[model samples]
Target: MAAVVRGMFALEPAQHRAESCQPGGRGDASGGETQPVESGEIPRCLLVGPKGSGKTALLFQYGLSLVRQGRRVTFISHETLHTMPLHVAGATKPDPLSLKQLQILYLNTQEALLKFLSSIHTQAPLPTQAPLPTAILVDDLDYYVSTAQTAESAPVVARLCAYLVDAAYFISNKLSEDKTSVAGRILCPVVATVAPPGDRTALQWYERFLTSVWEVKGVAGQPTMYQLSDASSAERAPLVVTYEIGGTLRVLDVQDLNEPMEGDD
Candidate 1:
């Protein structure tokens, strides 16, 4: 999922697999598992785009990529598409068995989503099994946050972000502190897709808690052409990724896209 646009956002979900190997790292004597708060876990990400700009497809691809690498992912959505076309960066077809590693949880309401997130924190301390998941992927976060009764209230958005951040921290630190990781330190990142609010003010409210942001915009003339912009960094201009969405996210050379970006929503 992250393999194609990863270059755009520089999201390396694979880092969680190698955190223990970092220099000067200390872990259990057997595996040198990364210690709590010691490993540099991948940052949680927010993929923002208008409808049909390929945000959900890209997310599914990213999670598939992580699963292919022997990592586990928990995908949550209030309304997952019944027929979402999915494939990894270079795969000819999405593997059927890989879906096992990608656990899909249908959280169908705003309250359900919040309660599920809160439950992750309150769950019994890190289990004595495999390490924590590599990533938590949420689709259509705007629906979850904006459909609440108090959607316009600041606390609505604030609490959601807080819950997500805490989950990332808990998955990263609590599991490692318990020395339950087989691959050293535990690293978990949360990635979610959101439809950009029509009002820029509302969009800004959501970004306040985002560690990374990638926006997908469509080409005006070419239906297959989409430009992905990495706005995660304020220090530099957002890097743009123009690509054609097929079975895979095939990158189109920058010189080929002569059309201006417009709406696909």
Candidate 2:
């Protein structure tokens, strides 16, 4: 089963607690402080963009970052798996999963994805050992949505979104169990990428559930640009993120860009 599933499970001692304890990190708050404003709250972020807009790359990069931060990451992608061989061929040494800690799930259909989630929910408890913090990265959510739309047995978009949300919540609950348990102490955030909506209204469905939304635009001979804002805010200017060829993601605040440059003055 492991051979066919591409599973890698390595239990490593907690290395950096500070990295996991940060506000946006995997150790997000579990209880008390506040409802939605808790310091350690897990985030549900959605990234929307056209083809070749670097959405998949950004998702993978985020997964790599989480792995580096000593967090367990489950990177699920149907599209990425189609090109996995090429990616593995060109992969650099000490690759992202070389540590054997990340759980990479290649799901091609909605049923498969749901089944995986269901298994996680019902799986037997882990031994009394500290589990690494966890996060989920789903690449190309639009593909799944489209797949469901074309299927005869698929549910409506709203129902599909609810299923996904339930899966995410189930995973989070499993990870955020009693601290002494093996699955306890883990924070699980769900981050996914979707193709830009053909009809703007398509976005309304995702926005209803996602905590944050980011839009990526790519232009020939220019850096890929990203605009990030809260899901509820329609009027707020997006915080821009520029992706450069050398793998640098420069975040530029729109307010800062609006200020007159010293040379311009």
Candidate with the greatest TM-score versus the true structure: 1
lDDT of 2 by residue, 1-265 (tens): 1110011111122123424544234454546321222322545667777766556655665565456666677888884455432121122323646446666778999788778766665654466643433667788877777877565322445655555566666555655554543422344667788887776677877777664676766645665554433343454322343443234343333322434778895
Write down the TM-score of every candidate.
0.76, 0.66
Full-model lDDT for every candidate: 0.64, 0.53
- Which parts of model 1 have CA positions greater than 4 angstroms off? 1-4, 7-34, 38-42, 125-132, 151-153, 236-238, 246-249, 254-265
Count clashes in each candidate, considering only residues at least 3 apart in sequence or on different chains.
6, 2
lDDT (C-alpha) at residue 80 in model 1: 62
TM-score of 1: 0.76
lDDT of 1 by residue, 1-265 (tens): 2323552322443334333432112234355445455333446678888776667777887777567656678888787668854443544345678888888889988788888778777665434543355578889888777688863645777788778777777766765566434545555667888887677677666667765677778889988778876665444233456778666566664421224566733
| Model 2 spans > 4 angstroms off | 1-41, 80-99, 127-133, 149-155, 181-185, 220-238, 245-265
